[model samples]
Target chain A: MDYLEKEILVLGCGNILFGDDGFGSEVIQYLQKNYNVPSNVYVDDAGLSVRTILFNIVLSEKKPRKIIIVDAVDLGKPAGSTFHLDVDEMPEIKCDDFSMHQVPTSNLLKELKNFCKVDVKIIASQVQYIPEEVSLGLSNVMRDSIPSACEMILKEMSPL
Target chain B: MGKRIIIQPVSRIEGHAKVTIQLDDLGNVADTRVNVVELRGFEKFCIGRPVEELPRIVTSICGVCPWSHHLASAKANDAVFGVTIPPAGKKLRDLCNSIAYTEEHILHFFFLSGPDFVMGPDADYSVRNVIGIAQANPEIGKKVVRNRHLGTQMLDIISGKSIHPVTAVPGGFSKPLTQKERDKVLPMAEEVLEFAKFSIAFAKENIFPKYLDTVKVLGVFNSGFMGTVSEDGALNVYDGKLRLMKPDGSFTDFAYDSYTDFIAERVEEWSYLKFPYAKSWGEGFSMDVDNPKGIYRTNSLARINVADKMATPLAQKEFEEFRAKFGRPAQLTLLYHWARLIELLYNAEHAVELLNDPEITSRETRVPVTPRAARGVGCVEAPRGTLIHDYETDDKGLITNLNLIVGTTHNNAPINMSVNQAAKLLIKDGKYDQGILNRVEMAIRAYDPCLSCATHNLDGRLPVRIDIVDSEGILINTIQN
Candidate 1:
């Protein structure tokens, strides 16, 4: 319930151990270093445990008004291209695809928006490369886009 | 001509996998295989990194069970540095492990595999999930969610973060619990204990009775078992020698460092995962369900069967009832769930006992570690099974070599055999439906396999595609779920 005191919650979700897929966590690092956000706004680098955090938010006695999730995606677009997606625009995720580190998080986000009456927004960036192996650090494209992603997240927080 | 039925990306588990069942011209079960995709090059990635960073780095291996990797890595580092932690440090680490076990067991029982029994396996897929369970049994669902929250909160108080902990350092815990902190945790531990009691009783009265037949026959297979036990042969998840028990209940206890001498990993051409067998038994590896050779299981059922008794009183009573019903070396795969609850009860009680200890609040938690060139192996009975982290460090304490035999990997062969046994019995004459397919999945889920930990992944998306192919390797049908 203490977490519900925040009006705006910004979550950066990704595994930093995988190349380019770490865009969200990097964006969080950039934001924490460059911006001084209001006390009402809460920011977290959720990494692969984003589902558990979202689950807590959905089932808590009190809820935040708006939630923004920053993540890396395989959108087949040019790398580092950022887009805003409402909860309804997210694709349906089958239960079979659910894993602690996988896209079953999308299903939880969708449920929070539709059932829990919380506004959900996703800021997804196209990744240049996600290593088939356990390579760390971000690609140049994702590394460069961190500043822009931070700016976009700041602009979204202005209304709150 | 033989036909293959593929169920891609088994749902409600920790990772993605494809289950293929092959039928001969007579429409009888010919073979069944579970193919897993490996997240390549993890050991290579660790090369040249400072050994101290491994405990932190390994947390990213799987989000579901980071504590297992973190603690195992820390213990391995302790051996590499050649230092023994103070009694307080070791107790704190065990306390954290027990709390984590409580959270994971609660999640698995009520949220994950619980639906199979709570909502009934034959229910429509749409109504056989956490959400459906909540809708059907709101009161129980609410309690489950609340208790899980409490567990996380307790973890947050003990360790700075519940998701990826940084407290368990090489020599000892980085943080010490003050008396005030211990007082705060005691109440939460008590609450979790109450819930643990309720959970086992509820399952016994409501769920297990309805599925007794399934418990007796589904995915049943004969295999050896492996777990950690104290010198007294009491179940000890935190620190103990490895106990390898044969199907006849005979066993051998060995130091964890000599694990390679007793256990061997076998590679299969069809899968990226390695199948581990008990090589010390001197029997060649075989996956024959009725007469498995060198095959063994880990995880909850294995731990309960291998140990002579539980360390805690309540759990000891439950263990007695379990053995009385199933006998020694229980082969019923579904009994894993039953065993899991017993362990949950044990962990909750263990946590409370550790908290009440005077050593828990001692300031002498860690010792200084000196770098050395040595090989060390650290093993702990993770919530899922026995997790081992073996590391070879250079003179500068840099990791030169590393190998991790995670819980799921140890059960890889048995998982395959269980799948085959279930498929052969349930899909006779090629008669099957989604329910039958789910029953097949129940076999795998009972292990509570964390394939994501076995082979890691990111991106939050795993696309599943099932293909039905003829004997000539031509795709006859394609199904995407």
Candidate 2:
């Protein structure tokens, strides 16, 4: 894999301040610490307002060939499994359950897709304890899957 | 030449809404309407869900005030569960509520609503938003952003996220606070406390004076006050009885959980919004001050009035002065913004105190309990007003039914009233100017209604259709009046 072709943008969306739903952010934090990727690869906290991040994508003039969003998707899956999905095919993400400050990155992706030609993907970890009384940390299963999920994402950005 | 207009989908405020204004016979605003449109089916959808799911389910009602919904839902769940949460749970919930208020008010004032006031009312539509705010006063703008960041940061440290918080549970919190997290949260809260203080002082000194004449001359000031009063007569947010005070100083109180007994909702033909009135008081007159019967308002100012006095010294002092100056708890709707800032101070201060408390960090974030067939009512002070969640559940902890009497629902009538008043006030003397009508729109935006959450349906665009009408209610030359 050529270094120049290894361009990857790993963006973690959603507010980490809100309990188990912050799994994506927690995963991003882990990836930031452990992942060894080419210089073209970049990671962003993105936070809860994923919509705001879209502007950077469209207006960057130098558009990236691909974008990956890491978030806690409520797929009713077991706590730890990783689901890689094409942004357009994922279930209609419900932005209501979270905070008002947030517009779903998926929604933002849909909006951006209209104006640009970026290959957008979502890497969502399932959340079982959202809306329940819980801490901000991911569940045990979600936490355990971080390294492997990060590795898979790195692999997807392969052929550099 | 035809005038240009742009209606941004899902107007960037609370809940969901869209704006539409018509051009005059001479390319000016002949009429304007800010549509409070969102068809949320929370009440209908909530029907038949297990009562225990009320807290979690209703928390999705609005991203802005999930904490309020969570509390109201939890309290309703508790009522249905036929068990009262312990004192610590109640206080912790109140603390969470306060944090929610602090975060929301700051978002509304500084980020959402503040832009118009800060960057001239007629600033370019695109730039008059957050980006515009960033360009105009970078220092204050950065401070506003940082203040919100600090508040959300603390919320994340405590509950998980500032929005869609996860700290709340049906029985209680999922986990208790650790000293380290509490310690981390405190200093950040202190910064927010400082910012909140600075905001109050800034309001008193800078912002308040600028809007003083505007408040006195232009804003809606005659609505009655409503809020939750503690058993001991305090401005209790988490667990308390509901109260609706009349403009003439009369009041009614019901068990917080028994919302159905005291309040009845009347839906208007023109709007999907429901206007709640005190069932005891009977119906409301159409914007008539003489026989004001509807449950008028909730949240910051009303909460200040319902409680004996504010717990914090600054808030108490401000509350006293506000009441003294306006006479009987400033009924003016615009003052809610100021009152919200004042409460932000109180909320931040309260959060600081909670964070500093050594016991807050204790590892008992949960209260073990089992669900039973019962009804519960949880009420909390959302940034807009008092939000009540009533739920009935089965023994298995599934929600059987749910009802969210949101703060915006109560203020629905007053919102239309204010809009009508502003339209009339601005359109007087045959003025069809866009700037004049924008002032009227700004007045309505000040309330920050969360109608989308009230209805349970989250999608709708408010295509504002403002038409000029004659004195006899006939359609006069229709324009964006």
Candidate 3:
């Protein structure tokens, strides 16, 4: 069996151009540099158009047992905090006013859920710079939470 | 000597612009100038990012046609990685492109450009918007609103967001469609098809003829025409070789890979925008030419002229009749709204066909591969016109450079010329009265330019200032979105 055939895929999505909204891309870049994962594990930077991410979901030969997405989300938490949630836990995240891209993510997810069966996980980092100009470096708070984000995702993917 | 009149901040347009009309001392029109105030920097920002990330990064530049950016950027990345996706991915990408164009056309005609036609040009600006449409004919107006909303919803369902879709990645879509999702869109697609058919008849019989008699025609000279041309010669909006047809009826088709060779942009001192013209047409101003060859019009007019046939039946019939009436390759600039409507009808019908295809719901969503760093270029026909994105990546696949040629950029010269022509024509006899400003604005809005989409710097910031001075002389309520 191929390495990518075994482990699930994790997609990091956001607009790196829009200040903190780029948190997902930033984290993905970090993971690409640091993490040494199982052979089947695939991670991608999806950017602002999550709809296009659907193609990536389709191309995986072995259906990812699970999929994880890391992004900077505004769940009304303190500016530099991080939160993790799965498909079941998604409802708890208030979706009253989504960033314009959120509408597309919701729409893509709706369409994708019907065709594939993969556990969906989101690790969102809240930040002050939603669209404000920011640097590539992660905030201290989000930086600290990276380890936990990685740990939780790994645990979820691990076989008991 | 020529007199100049400046119309600053032309009213009822999406972006900022200033128009200058150059009139001979005898009050005859001499020349025209239009200055678009916005400046974009997409190339500078493309530097230092992975080529694969270009599609996802550039998608945020516009809220209207992110799908175009997504496809173009993805194509660019595909070039760098040297990956060719399956035919299904290409078809799905085309479907997404078609949806984007329809949604944008609906918004432009029904919401933005609809008022100028449905309501008289002389109608008060305040009452010439969607609200005005609702107030005038409640039922007809509701249909327009519903169509636009339904189109947006359909786009939202498929592409993730209606305006700027991110789901169109390089190689293929992020996932495949399901029977349930396909079912949700089937009925809506049918409704849109019905609405478009009704709208086309409405436009041809009732709307267009009414406006034709008094409609202000701008630009006496027929200039260069350019658009994406597929190998099959259908109006290739998703991706294709670009074709440029000169006023002399001679045409040249360049593979989008050879884009840099055929297209050359000239920078003017008066405006921040650059004028893109065909390279074979010669560089700089030509004196032997009676008409200004440097100024060329793009978008719908160019797309219609460059393609041999349209994919949809209704649009093809309309294209023939339109050419017969207005000459082969119609140049009546305001008639773009009509052409856009025709294309919308085609796109809606096509979207339905793609949605019904069982293969579109296939389980094989993505094929994994290794990333090889290289240069890539992607081009698609956007709602406005052909949009091209080019990227150069480092060994690790990070983008080192980027170049994006949006539809609006291609029309900078013609837009200026159109505004100038309208001002000169309407303002004849030296009286600042009656429909001059409206006519000028209508000319610019014809292209449906989205300036925000041109903003390229992913991390760039602008100094936005909002001033409210209190009695004590202190600035209050400083905020940003």
Candidate 4:
């Protein structure tokens, strides 16, 4: 419930079991450990349960002014490359195709923006290697990108 | 002259899977197969790790059913350490399981598979989704969303986090329920119970009647069933003896550790996942739709079928009514939804019953534990089906071996059989469209099989691509939706 009281909310979404997919969660860790976050801001490692958390936020009485999501995606770009996308810029996903566990984080972000009137932004890094096996820890390229992703998230929070 | 039709990444279910239907030269359905990507190296990942860390580590297995894994692992840890959890600890774990079941059943019935029944299965794909359901029936949609949110809120209040719980430990729960916490949760439990009542009544009155015929015949097959039951032969999800029921409604019960004596897993060359049948039944495995040899099912319908009665009163009544209509061991695949709702009622009522128990708030939540070398098996009725965790540890308290048979894996063979039967019935003379293909997928969805959990994918993307090929394995067409 305290999460709803924040002016800004940052969600790090991905599975830590996969190599590069843990980037978003790692960014959240880096931010919390190294930065001086404002009291009005709340950072969460949403993990694979992003939809559940987002649903709770949507139904909450109090809503954050702005929500930022950090994720690792397959954007067909060079490994470790990062980009920012507004809610509208996300790809169109079929409504019926949505899943609570496997849904693209952007779809929920868009829904919150249109339905709840909240400003939404996504910070994404192109994944380098997602292992087929049960592997932990990120690839070196993704590991190197974590600091920049953390700085970018901090800069986004600065204006707020 | 023959043709093959594939439906990849069947939508509206957990994880990813593909369905392939092969046709003969005359264009009649010849054979069918359901393929899944199984996650490898998982058990290997547990090797050399401290056994106590399993309850925490296993939560990462599946995002959807973390509580089930959390508690099952905790119970396994208790067994391994040869410690009995205190009464408060056991009640707390059961309480969390009941609440988790309510949330999962509601989500699956209303959002995941609700579209097929609510909007009509033949409805356009665009309008047959959660959003479409909201637009079509705003009143019901509002209630569903609010009630589901309440379920999540209840979990958050009790377990600290709804997705990946940390309270369950080797001997007991890490946290106890204070009087104030129980007081806050009591009203929420009551609200969820009322919603559970409304859900079944609403579905019975509005949904099931229209699909009665389909309910009886769609994906119908004969198979044995499995579930957990109390000593008095009543349904118990968290703790009980395993009941393996024959297709004729007769059953035999066994202790959790004695599972190997009754059950065995068979692996097929075509699929990475294993097929688990009743080995004690003394029949070799076969998915032949006409006469399946050793096929059996687990999940809501199976649980309802295998149990003598429900422990909770409301669910017991519903079980009687369900049996009156479908007979014992209901073969109707679509009835899983109905059975799921009934279990929801049971879980909600069970939660309230636990919350009202005096020992639920007792201060002694955990018992001290000393670890030694031991092998233990923990079993629970996951929302999808029966989940079992088998673990072995060295004297140093480090895991030596681990094996997990998730709820969905138990239904792997049956899912393939159901899809095959449905496809053979629906697609005639190679004539089928999107709706027909979806009907085929409906057969699989009835199982609510969580291939993601079965496969253990960290990145939850199961891209489904349906490829149509000719008799000679030549590419003919491709379908992606």
Candidate 5:
């Protein structure tokens, strides 16, 4: 990865209206407020449609050297447990669907990594729960892990 | 035993859905239902919240077309406050809607639905996607990517943010298009217009003609259509009364706020989505393909069918060409792709036209408003279909009651009917392959239904756990893959 290009992207992905699903977005807000982002790094909250960014990146000639996606997961770990996941580690997913939105995230990420030659990283926290209905806010465990999540990302963002 | 063929997690449209097809003893299709699994409970959750917040909150409903929800909700807020938005403000909203449509339609036509036509419907699944299109045609792929990026950038320049926009405020827009901003985006708008022109031409010459046979036969059905039109009956996506057209081409125009009077939603136990029918039609809603009662279609095909003519010259020409070939109320489901291209051209030209207007940069974009107890309904032609947002507010402007009819939800009945029809037409003798099932999916793709919610799971273990249950709700068989 070209650490000099500053072409690194840190994305926080999830829906803020879907309980613990908002953990990633909340972490992004925390990172923006507390951390001083370097010139080479661009941090954003891609929210529910991160697929748009990943899809564009895959199609475009110019691409970021590295990408770190922050999200919440329920991998049966204790709530708020943070860990790293490579693109290959993600579960297989369906084609990009509409139901007006496709979180075609996993598949798009795989494409970006294997074909686009980009270094992709996922820093996911164990979500307490994701609500089916429109509930807001993260669980206390997930919310408390925001700072730790940001730190983990910052570590990954270190000069390649 | 009658056979049930289930294609779970229908792919490449918006959110995921499932299609279950039933076959009778002779192996011909008996019935079919497309099951949509997630529910946002948007109305119940938003109740008691301040109405102004809806414009922002609704953006989270779907990331693909957040601008539609944002603007529609803002319009509803404007209605509740009873303020006439400034001309400049309305123009800004229209500008955003057109640009968003360009991005969305391009994504659908090239990447999602494009794979089927560009690569052939029976093409191997591995090479039928965005990558396939890019590898096959690199130049068009690059232009498509750059243009989509430009769309988001232009939105960010017009409003403060692009993804979850909060710029459309009650009574008017919060931001004004400065002269400098207008100059910056004008050429970008023209670039998109050039691509739009090329896109429709390419589809007509290369794509549509190749599939004319399939377009005629697959998923054909007779159904009414819905969309918005100006008082002059010209197609206007931003503002207009609702035009609900019958299968025979006769129609009724009703006020936006009076939607409840003409439209009624029917709930089915099997689907998370509701079937909205023409309550004003006097025939009760039914999914019968031979004679669908009160069932009407929305989205691209419906939008064009309901409109008398396109507002832009280029689109109007294409519209005339389309009508000459297919005739009015085109019942062929695949014609949706054709109709979608017309809207893309119209939106691109419309964007260029609006950017040229001097009033678009005027500073008086919004008016002040005080809260009062009132009912308001806002409607817009979302890329998916006609999106309607109705809100009833208390004296404090808190939402007391709310109902939302998303563009895709309007096609719920039509989708099931089309799936049933396609399954019946294609799967004779109960012989079906991945290609056959995917073709049935093509019927739903024409509508371009957006499910509006992400399918969540515990640590990516979705579509992995299978629970086999019997009619008595007993866990008789279990399969985990």
Candidate 6:
């Protein structure tokens, strides 16, 4: 489907090459392997390309109605805790980020939510241990949380 | 008292760009350092993995330029496995590189560095961005987005996936382009070529003229240039001999295998990034703009400056005009934008040219390969700069050592030099405004350095928060724009 045709996007946003940092995509993998998400809800592992995908949506003339982000986060909760976080609650991690595209700032998600009028939401799990280097796969704690995260994501998109 | 000022933008993803600028007692710029994250850990991570798997795994390091990594890794693997890919295989790789460059150069020009040139550098932060560009130039914005999407769509059709591509394997491209796929992609390449023409024309007429004054001064510095070029000195990003052009327009061409003899890294305090200088120049290292010793740049501006000519006609014409105007080895950093547009046109033309070749659709893309203990060095001109992936393997084909001198790493010192030059020129007597700071940001933006490629954070955009402090580190002024 064309990107605009999708009403909701469930984007798994993290690199799986890094240990527990792959939580978001791990959930997406679990969903792809296990669940049957409807066509209206587009799901994929965004990985490190999250910013570019989000930037495209913001620049796009027609945006999806909602963007659901699934990623690993450090909320200081239990290692495997999964929860829904509001965009406003996201730390000022937002900045004038510069990659090749040098996509501009506030936070991109916040921009989608506030400026673009898209319902942007996040489903995140506290990482057990994100390796300082490249160590593939999720730790048992983070790996164990994937099914619940997938379930939570499906439940959130239940209206769809 | 001298002051240490830190310009940091917080990002949880990959620790983003952290630039530290030191000020003398008079509040004049003393020094600047573009602090990027380390890649050594990731290098070590590749050690135990199978040599063949590296081409797939390395793409995970940077989302922004995965294709560049994928190709470089594949090339390195080919060198290790001692196999020369079939003609169709080489064409496929070249075609993909050109297409990816088309996508990258367009996005960097229209989205990343667009606003500063289009809206004027001093415009307010809110309206001086991508959304603002869309609002102001709706038609142009649409074209930019559409052309970029077309590039992605083409990559998707060529390779099964655009992001984290594994199509580029050790011996050759894993997949070949079918005639039907080539036919489908041809029109898109032609369309992007048209856009590339419009983009450069638009910039020359509207965007560049307004910023010419700023271009002359901001980030202005003299340094050597580095890039890849074909045998006859034509600009070739996919495969070529490495050229290191000195500040005086003189250059030395060398093979990638002997890159270590020409370039060496100065490990200053073992920071997140390594400072590589021209060892062959034998000037040690320095970022002093007035008398930079061994500093050299690698990116669009550098590529254009070093190359004798562009491979394609339209780009060659644009390149001639650029060289005629700026002279060879342009010192003005802002001209990177100008040089970038020229490359954009080159890639666009190159893509169309590649698509026209019959071999691009050939099925004999891959060749047989046998694993053996070997060391290989592969280099490509990534959109940002020269990307060198050096690797070694055991007899069993397991990786023993690997070092990736990514595009951004080559520009590490020059970025600092540009920011320092910008800071020195703009900030005076400890007084500065958001406009001044944005200009400072603009200098760094001109190179269009991929911070994600630098530090592995896809969203590693630099939201510069400059803090001015005294020698004792007492914060006096903070500018967060």
Best prediction by DockQ: 6
Q: How far off is residue B268 in model 2, in Å?
A: 1.7
Return the clash pairs for model 1, or none.
A102-B460, A103-B460
lDDT of 1 at B115: 84
Q: What is the lDDT of residue B470 in candidate 6?
A: 80
Tell me the tens digit of each residue's lDDT in model 6 across B390-430: 99998888889988898888887888888888989987876
- Model 5, span B1-481: residue lDDT tens: 4566766566676776777776776777878888886565767999999999999898887877899999999999999999999999999999999999999999999888998998887887657667777889999899899889888888889996888888899989899999999999999999999999999999989999899999988888899999999998888888989999988899999999999898999989987778899999998988989988998998889888888899899999999999999888888999999999999999999999999999999999999989889999999999888999999999999999998888888888989998998998899985777688779989989888888633332222222122323334555443322
Please give the TM-score of chain B in predicted model 1: 0.97
Candidate 3's docking class is incorrect
The 10-residue segment of model 2 chain B with minimum total lDDT is B456-465
Q: Provide per-model DockQ scores.
A: 0.39, 0.08, 0.05, 0.34, 0.41, 0.43
Tell me the spans in candidate 1 whose CA falls farther than 4 Å from its real position: A1-6, A59-61, A88-106, B456-466, B477-481
TM-score of chain A of 1: 0.87
The segments of candidate 5 whose C-alpha lies over 4 angstroms from its true place after superposition are A1-6, A91-106, B453-481
True contacts kept of 4: 0.24
Cα TM-score per model:
0.95, 0.74, 0.71, 0.93, 0.94, 0.95
The complex in candidate 4 yields a DockQ of 0.34
Q: With candidate 2 superimposed using the best TM-score fit, by how many Å does residue B5's alpha carbon deviate from the native?
A: 12
| TM accuracy, model 4 | 0.93
- Across A1-160, the per-residue lDDT of candidate 4 in tens digits comes to 3566788999887778767877888899888898898888888877766766675565455678889889887767899988897666543322212244222232456667887898887898888888888889988888888888888888888764
Model 5 — interface RMS deviation? 6.2
Q: Write the per-residue lDDT of candidate 1 for residues B182-279, one digit (tens) a residue.
A: 89989999999999999999999999999999988889888899999999999999998999999998999999999999999999898899998999
Q: Write the per-residue lDDT of candidate 3 for residues B1-481, one digit (tens) a residue.
A: 3455555434334444556665566665566676664434456656776666667656666544677778888787777778787666776787777766766676677656777788867786546654465567666656655665566567657666553456766677775667787799789888888888887788788778887754536533467788877798778777778888887657888888788887887777887777787767775543112367645567887888777888777778877876777765667787787778778877887888788777777766555545666778888888777788777777887777777778888877777767666666677654443355566778888888755454322221211112222335454333221
Better of 5 and 6 by TM-score: 6
* Candidate 5: residue A28 lDDT (0-100): 87
Model 2, A28-98: lDDT tens digits are 78887887666777665555444433533433334567777788776678777788866655554444322
i-RMS for every candidate (Å) is 5.1, 10.4, 13.6, 5.6, 6.2, 5.3
| Alpha-carbon lDDT of model 4 | 0.83
In terms of docking quality, how is candidate 4 classified? acceptable
